[model samples]
Target: MKAAVASALRAARRVLAACHESPDGDCLGGALALCLALERAGKRVVVASTDGVPAVYRFLPAWERVTDRVEGLGSFDVAVALECADLERAGRFAPVLAACPVLVNLDHHRDNTGYGHLVWQDPQAASVCEMVYALLAELGAEVDEPVATCLMTGLLTDTGSFRYSSVRPETFELAAELVRRGARPDRIYELVYESRPPSAVRLLGLALSRLQLSADGRVAWSVVDEAMLQQAGARWEDTENIVETLRSIAGVRLALLFKVEPSRVKVSLRARDGARANEVAARFGGGGHLGAAGFVARGDLEDVVRQTLQAAAAEVQTGSG
Candidate 1:
C-alpha cells in the first residue's frame, strides 16, 4: 500500500477522474470524494463522466466543474477511475487511462478485472468510497468538511443509508465522525431519497404498474422502455429508483428492473435475504453488491427480457431458503 501511495503521489500531481456512464450514487459519490481529497492535497483535479451528474449531486462542492468530455484530459499526470469494473466502463474517457503516466483503479465490485496500474479491489469493503477512505488515511491526509461530505455521501448511498448488511459497526462510527466534521445527514438524505421531480414520480408509478411476479410469487420483475419514459417525460436518470419497488412485495427474494437504452438494455438486480446478486450480474460483465447489482445486455429488449427472466428464475429456485 505504501508503494502504491508513493506511485500515486508521484504521478497524481495533476489528476483527472472518471466514473461509469449513467452515473449511480456510488459512481458519482466515489469519484467526487476522491477528487475533493486530491484537490486538498494541492493537486490539480478534473472530474468527468459520460452519463453526466444527476441533479441530486449538483449541490456537491465543485460539482459545476464536471464536464461530459474532459478536454486535454490526457495532459494530466495521473487519472483515477472509481466504482467501475471494466476499463470500457469509462466510455469515451477510457483513453485518458492510457494517456496518463499512472492510473489508480478503485472499486468494490467482485468482477473488477484489475484494469489500473495501481489496483485496489476489495469486494468486502462495501463501497469504493471505503477503499478511498483507507487510501486517504494511508497518505495521512486530513478529512476536512468537503472530503467528509463526499465520503459520507458515498457511504450513505452504497449501504442504502446504513440499512443493508454491509453496514458494520465501523460504518456507523464513520458516519458519526463525518457528522462531527460537518457532514449534514438531513440535507443529503432529503436530496437523495425525498426530492424528485413530478415526472419521476409518474415514471415510478408506471414501472410499478408493470411489475410481475414469479409463479410461486418469490421473484418480481419490471421493465421501463424508452417509450414509457418519453410518455412519462422521465429522463434516463429518473429511473434509478424504479428497482426498489419490485422487491417491496412480501416473499419476494429477487427483483429485476430492465431499463431500455438506445443501443442496449441495462439490468438492475437486487436480492433480499442472503441472495448473491453480484454473481448473477457477472454473467453479463457487470456487478455490484450481493443485494444490488447491474448488467448491460446486447441485442433487443425482448432478448434482454428473456435472458434476465430466465437467469432470475434459476437464481430464485437455487437461492431459495
Candidate 2:
C-alpha cells in the first residue's frame, strides 16, 4: 500500500493533501510534511482543512500554506487524505475528494472505513506521521528541518508526549532521527503544551469543577457549554486535552468530555487499558483509537451525555469483568 501511494503521488503533477475536520496535531503534521516532501519532488501541492489551523499548531512548518477553501483551487491529479477515518471526516471537503480521479487514504485509525482508491492503514501506528516518514523514504524525499519539525509534532501530540501505550522502540528511533534533522522536542513541547492562554486555563478549571463520576467510579464525565466558553473567553479549541485529564483520575476507566454546541454536542472519549473507548464512540456513528475516540450527537446536551455515559459504563463493566 505504501508503494502504491508513493507511485500514485510520483505520477501526479498536481496533488491535494488534506486532513480531517477540526484536525489535531497528527493529521495536520502528517499532511504538511507530505506537502513539503511532494513540493520538493516537483509536484504542485495544495493543503486544505475545513476548520483551518488551530492557534496551537501554527508553529508547524508551512502551516501558513494550509487553506480552508479548496473549491476554487481547480482540479487535482490525486488527493491524499491524512489521518481521516473516512472521507466524510474531511468535512465539507469530502465531495471534492470523492470527485478526484484518484484518492489515497493514509490513516492510523482502527475504525477506518477504507474509502479511497488506495488505502494504507495501520492501527498500531502511533500516528500517521510514522507512515508519512516511511512514505518519504519510499519516494526518496529528504526529511529536511521543516519536514522533521512537522512530523515530530504529530508524534509528540498523538502519543501524549510519548506517554501512551502506543509508543514503540521504532517510535523513539524515529524521534531521534527527526531530532538529528533539526526538530526540537523541547520547543515543540513548550509551544503545544505549555503555551495555553489564560482563557483556556480558565476553561479547563470550569470543566474540572463540574467533573462527575459514575456510581461505580468507572466512568468520569463533564460538560462545557457555550456559556462556559463565553464566561472564560475561550474558543472551542481551548477544550482540548480536558478529556485526558478526566481519564487520569484514580479508578476511572473511561473519561468523557462533552462540548455543547448550539445544535449538537461533541463528545470526546478517553479510556484506560482494556476499556474500548472507540467501541463506545462507534455506537454513536464515531470511531477512533481504542484509548481515544469521539462522536457528535444532535440533541440536548444532558440527553446526549446520558446516552453516551450509559454506553461507556457498559463497556467499562464488560472490560472489568
Candidate 3:
C-alpha cells in the first residue's frame, strides 16, 4: 500500500492538502486524515480550503488547523486534492495547487478526470478515508486517539452512520475499533443530526412548501434562491438538511434540492428505492454514491434546474426500465 501514497509524496519535500469547497464529511475527513499522516511523516503539511471548517466538524483535532487565506501563501512540494476533482474544486487553494511542484488527486469520485500529476481514484473504495486508512497503515504510523477519531468521522459520515449500502462488514469493524480507541459515535451523531439552527428550520419549511413532484411522484424537487435565503435569513448550512426531507417523502424515489447562488447553483441529489443519484450527478460533472450525489451548475437557476430535473428523470426512467 506504500505505492498508494508513495509515488506522490516521494517526489516532494513540503506538501499542501485540500478538499472540495463547501466540504461534507468525506472531504474534511479525507483532508485531515492525510494531513495528520503527512505531518507525522516529518513533512510540512498545510490543509486548507475556501471556508473555515464546518461547524459540527469542529470537534476534529485538525479542524482548527485549516486556513482560508489563498494569496501570498508559501509554495509546496506536492499538492494533494482530497475528495476533490479539479483546481476550481479546490476553491481558495487554487493558487497553491497551481504553484506546487506536483499534484496528487485522491478521491472516490467516478467522474473525477484525474486532475493532478498523481491520481488515486478508487470508486469502489466507498470513501477516500478508507484509502487514507491504508496509507496510514502502510506508513507504519501509530493510530492514536486523534487519528482514529478523524478517520472515523469520515467513515461515519460517508456511510451515513452505517445506514448506507456502502457500509461493508469491514467498515463497521473498523468503526467499532475507532470507537474503542475514542471515536465518540454518540457525540458525532448528536452534533450532526441533533443540531439545527432556527434559520434551518425555516428553510426546511420553505423547501417543503415548494416541493415539486415529477411524473408518478418518483422525483421530488425544491429550489431556494438567494432571494429566499435573504428573506429567511438563511445560509447554505441551513439548507443542507432540508434536501433529505424531500428525499424521504413516501414513494418519492428521487429528491433534488438546489440552492441557487449568485454565481453557481448548488445541487444536492438524494434517492431511495434503488435510484442512482450518483449516475445523474456524474452526467453533470459531480461525484458521489448511488444514493447521494451533488454538483454545481453555473447558470441561470431556472435553466440549470430544468436541465438537472430532465437528467434525473432520464436516469430514473433508464434505470427503472
What TM-score, over all chains together, does every model reach? 0.81, 0.85, 0.79
Candidate 2, pairs of clashing residues? none
Question: Using alpha carbons, what is the TM-score of model 3?
Answer: 0.79
Off by over 4 Å in 2: 223-231, 258-268, 278-290, 293-315
Model 3: pairs clashing at backbone N, Cα or C within 3 Å: none
Model 3 CA deviation exceeding 4 Å by range = 1-4, 7-12, 209-214, 221-233, 256-269, 274-318
Residue 85 lDDT, candidate 2, scale 0-100? 80
For model 3, how does the per-residue alpha-carbon lDDT over 121-227 read when each residue is reduced to its tens digit? 87766777777877777767667778787888888788878887677777877888778888887877787777877787887888899889985788899988777
Lowest lDDT sum, 10 consecutive residues, model 2, at 312-321
Residue 231 alpha-carbon offset, candidate 1, angstroms = 6.0
lDDT (Cα, 0-100) at 131 in candidate 3:
76
Using TM-score as the measure, the top candidate is 2
Give the Å error, residue 59, model 3: 2.0
Q: Give the TM-score of candidate 2.
A: 0.85
Report the lDDT of model 3 for residue 67: 82
Error of 2 at 150 (Å): 0.7
Candidate 3, lDDT over the whole model = 0.80
TM-score of 1: 0.81
How would you encode candidate 2's per-residue C-alpha lDDT over 25-129 as one tens digit per residue? Answer: 999999999999999989999999999998889999999999998658899999999978878989888898999999999988777898989999988899999
